[model samples]
Target: MTNEMDNQLAGVGGAEPAGAPSRQEDRPAEIAPTAPEPDTASSERGKSSPEQHAEDAARTNDAYSRSFPSLSEGDVVQGVVVHIDREGVLVDVGTKSEGIIRRSELSRDTSIPAEEIVSVGEKIDVYVMEAENQDGNLILSKKRADFEKAWERVQEAKEHNRTITAMVTDRVKGGLVVDLGIRGFVPASHVGTGSMKNNLERYVGQSIPLKVIEVDKERRKVVLSNKLALEEDKAHRKAETVASLVPGQTRRGVVRRLTNYGAFVDLGGIDGLLHISEMSWTRINHPSEVLKEGQEIEVVILKLDLDAGRVSLSLRENQPDPWASVADRYHVGDLVTGVVSRLVPFGAFVRLEGGIEGIIPSSELSTKKGTKSGYGIAVDSEVEAKVVDVRPEERRLVLSLKQARREEEQRRERKDVEAYQTQSGGDELRYTIGDAFRAQQQSEEGTDQEEE
Candidate 1:
């Protein structure tokens, strides 16, 4: 009989293969309730082995003391998994009674597999909701353990300003859903300056950095943002870049955005305006035609307003100036041929040999005409012009089509006389009165026919 009692006691401890048992066998076989001994002194006299009974009672009391405290409604404790069934996992939390954490309480989510979260020997923290119900089993919670762990991680990340990387699991209004074991929010603005598109779907399987902007443990709410981190880095880099910038310096930049007035160029951490006026020497009606997004170009810094944090850039300054050599290439009184390009009320614009325009006033429009319709010039017609005035400083030129022809005729006649004199002496070139009259009459006849 003594051996039988010892075996039952041995089974109570380490009964679960060298581990704590799922539950305590406290009742053992109940002793018959013989009406209390007729008297204490009589009981004592009847006890033949008083010392042995005293030791057994002492051991039983110690075992009960070592068992888990009677769990209250909100006691938290650690436990080891001794058995797992389809319904739930049974854990030995030092309580004589096993804690029955339903599968639903095992995880905040009902769909999570119990085996994946715990194993036969793995130790886990649990919360006690009931030490022993009428059914005599302790009610425990595994989800609370997981939540406590998450909260610790969140607090650590916040203190160190560390980034938490998480995968996008869902899409909700104004933001995305991220799984940090707990659902977290990543606002749309926190994606990237409000320009990130397809972010929710594209980041579904990808992990991205997040800043824990807000956390509410009781409410189990977490908010995260990636844009804040990105903007902070950009601001730091921009300040460094702006400090190093100077006027008149040239750098390579990308056209980031274009507007009607100008284009915004990305000069690393800074943005510069490449105004439409500075795009070219000629007129530019719009910035798009002159600048394209993502185009890499060399630009000169016209002005750097550090206080205002603005940079002015110019692209046309790098091109050669056409007016730089105007004076050296052309001269006053020089006979030049040009095409009539434009006509105005005051004068006609003539294009010279090298894509330059000169003005020929109405008074200078006449050719060798003797009648009222003598000047019959048409638009786009080519004409010989004399450079009467050249104002290279102002990039202006005054031309005379009529004066050029007269100068050419005088030069031809003078050349003929000089040739005759050199060959046969000047005496043979003299003309008499009748000879002059005959030449004048012939000239008149040719003029009349030309006019007709």
Candidate 2:
């Protein structure tokens, strides 16, 4: 059994032992030796130590920091919104991590949702509220950033006497509040060119141009004015208008105000005085009879005082003069009917056609004896008169009522004589004359006999 076991072991060592030559003879011919591989860890150790690798990584981090600037509290940096939610917006400000803008920091209107203020992928400027929070996130603000930038611009505008446009956000007790990236106040008195006593509400939600009057940075107070800007522009235009005005020129104007004596007309930017005497050709007791406020009319530039900035306008000058052709319409000895206009101590005034007034002397007022000065002719009564004198140059006309009555009586007497001659023939007329003479002779004889 030992012998068999040894033979089997020999056979296992060499599978072909039974038929194979020797073990050394059975080996493959021309076998070459192989080279062992190098240890990877040992090679790496030779190139660089772990500490060296750590140093390389640190250097790379520093280069990255130089490329992208670091952020700090209160720093104003530009960023892009990555996401928007009810709480706030996630903004990528090139920091170690994305910045968080809380809902309160989005805008002054806290009631509005954050999504309405900022949208994803929208670039905005943010103020660093905190460099890093407890959760290792940056806290940012959008409203504060906007406020800072607006303050800088406002300060510059105030210094340069510049004008800006803003929307009126709210109405307050003393004035209105406007949003110029920040709160700007406009007092009620400065709201417009005229009085705004109860019209402050009209400016709400309106966007208007304003001039920066005052700015207090520490107090965050800014005062703006709309009236001042308007006044300044008006003054400039008025100067130009005044310079261009010339006497005897016609212009269109709007009635701005009225007084007992005259009306003020706005000729573009400047105001001109329109005297009551120049309102019409005839006469007027008050300016309201001819004009009203805001009435547009054509006026003649009667006079201009450039140095004093005064203008005299006339509306009647633009109309035809009534006295220009008075002589052609009236003449002496012409009988006319007129209305008794006014009474005076010496005589009464009679208004003829075309507003022409004629004077009737007290002596000419009546033809009958024992009569009053006015001859019972009250004011506004109608009467007939003869034109005795006419002086159109002096705007005077003399009338005689007595002469008119005397002429009428003479005409009636002539008419009565004509009627008597027509009723009797020629022979009858002769006989009547003879009889009249005989009656006179008989009367004389009787008287003589009585005397004897």
Candidate 3:
């Protein structure tokens, strides 16, 4: 058997002679060992294998390729304070090395104590100025982190229509700088609708509600407005107050402010004006004399104009009108004693009982003077005056201090004549005596008119 046949017979694992040809007729022709390959088959195998390799390469490349999270130059990161030293604080950033933060960068507010801003073992947010320092440590900052966080919050507030509390820090060119920790701006015009002449510094350290109007994270700017928020709140409360109020309904209020035309009273969340004319039944020289800021008093809702958002109030409405029942107590020609409450250029004001006051005209002030005058009487002096006219319908009282004495004398003379007439009979009275006396006198003078 040939070597090839011997090898094939051994693969069959049968006990057969090597020289025997088991199936020589069934043997197929095979390529020689030194034969060269064809160009087409070689090129086809090369192309097919390369394509398969390219597909595997693409899958491997895709597995390794992914989008990395972006971190800008001024971006900040958060970490925990693991160490505190004389230089500053060291934070563990979960990186290769600890980040060193300077003491100055801990807080923009210089007055704040270092311990208040952060403490050891407390996790906090920080800014990442350098991902790695020369020593391969992450550079972190607390101030920048605070500002970044505040900016994000401001933007969220703007989008979500949320209200934030911020402290007014400083004053700028045309507005105030609010330390939202992000340095927000509030224009001077938006400080208040009325007036804000007060120092803005006084508002420092005070927390106030604010609404975000603008946010610029790139520029690190935030603009806030309190006026809009205040207006909205005021509008809602004003509507409720107007709905609750009705004409003739009285309530207590505090004097909030004053103007030339009236004084504004604070009735809970809303304000109502008590005009100078509505302050009292009598004339008022000024509203301040009767009304002052922070003074509490009862006021009546006279008129409520909701469309205009205005309310008219009166301080005198709660009191009963003394003139309404005045006529029942006194009548015309009645002599009443009162105090001279005030002396004006035109007349003297006399205050009667029950807070009633009447003006005595300048022409009827005094009887002792040749002309009616108030020279001798001063304000607050007690004086007797007679009521010449009492017009309760008009709520007016006309008095005559001078003519009262004359009328009293005339009344006495009439009473004396009536008594004399009643004591003597009618015919035997002074008529007969006077007739005899007059006849003798005429005879003596031959009538005075003829003699003249």
If the candidates were sorted by their lDDT against the true structure, best first, what order would they fall in? Answer: 2, 1, 3
Identify the runs in model 2 with alpha carbons over 4 angstroms from their true place: 1-157, 163-172, 175-184, 188-210, 216-220, 333-388, 398-452
Candidate with the larger lDDT of 1 and 2: 2
- Ten contiguous residues minimizing lDDT sum, candidate 3: 443-452
For candidate 2, lDDT tens digit of each residue in 26-105?
A: 56656634577999878766777788799778999889868867787889999999998877889999976789988889
Give the alpha carbon lDDT tens digit for every residue of 186-287 in model 1.
888788565756456666667877888998878888989878766776788798888778788888999999998999998887899999989875445688
TM-score of 2: 0.51
Q: Where is model 1 more than 4 Å wrong at Cα?
A: 1-157, 162-172, 177-184, 189-191, 194-210, 216-221, 325-452
Pairs that collide, model 1? 68-94
Instruction: Estimate candidate 3's alpha-carbon lDDT, on a 0 to 1 scale.
Output: 0.77
Q: Which prediction has more favorable TM-score, 1 or 3?
A: 3
TM-score of every prediction relative to native:
0.43, 0.51, 0.57
Per-residue lDDT of 397 in model 1: 85
Can you tell me which runs of candidate 3 are displaced by over 4 Å? 1-87, 90-101, 119-123, 128-139, 160-165, 194-211, 251-261, 266-271, 281-283, 293-298, 318-348, 352-355, 359-400, 403-452
lDDT of 3 by residue, 1-452 (tens): 59999988787676657777764334555632456767985675677577778987898766654332334357666688998866778998665457888888888875677677788999988888887668766677898788778777888999997878888877777778887767789887677552567466666667777888888888877788877777777777766776789899998889999888889998877899899988877666689878888999999999888778688999888877788888998788889988898888878999888867887888887544344356657887998888988888988898887677556555665575677779885656574556545544454344223323
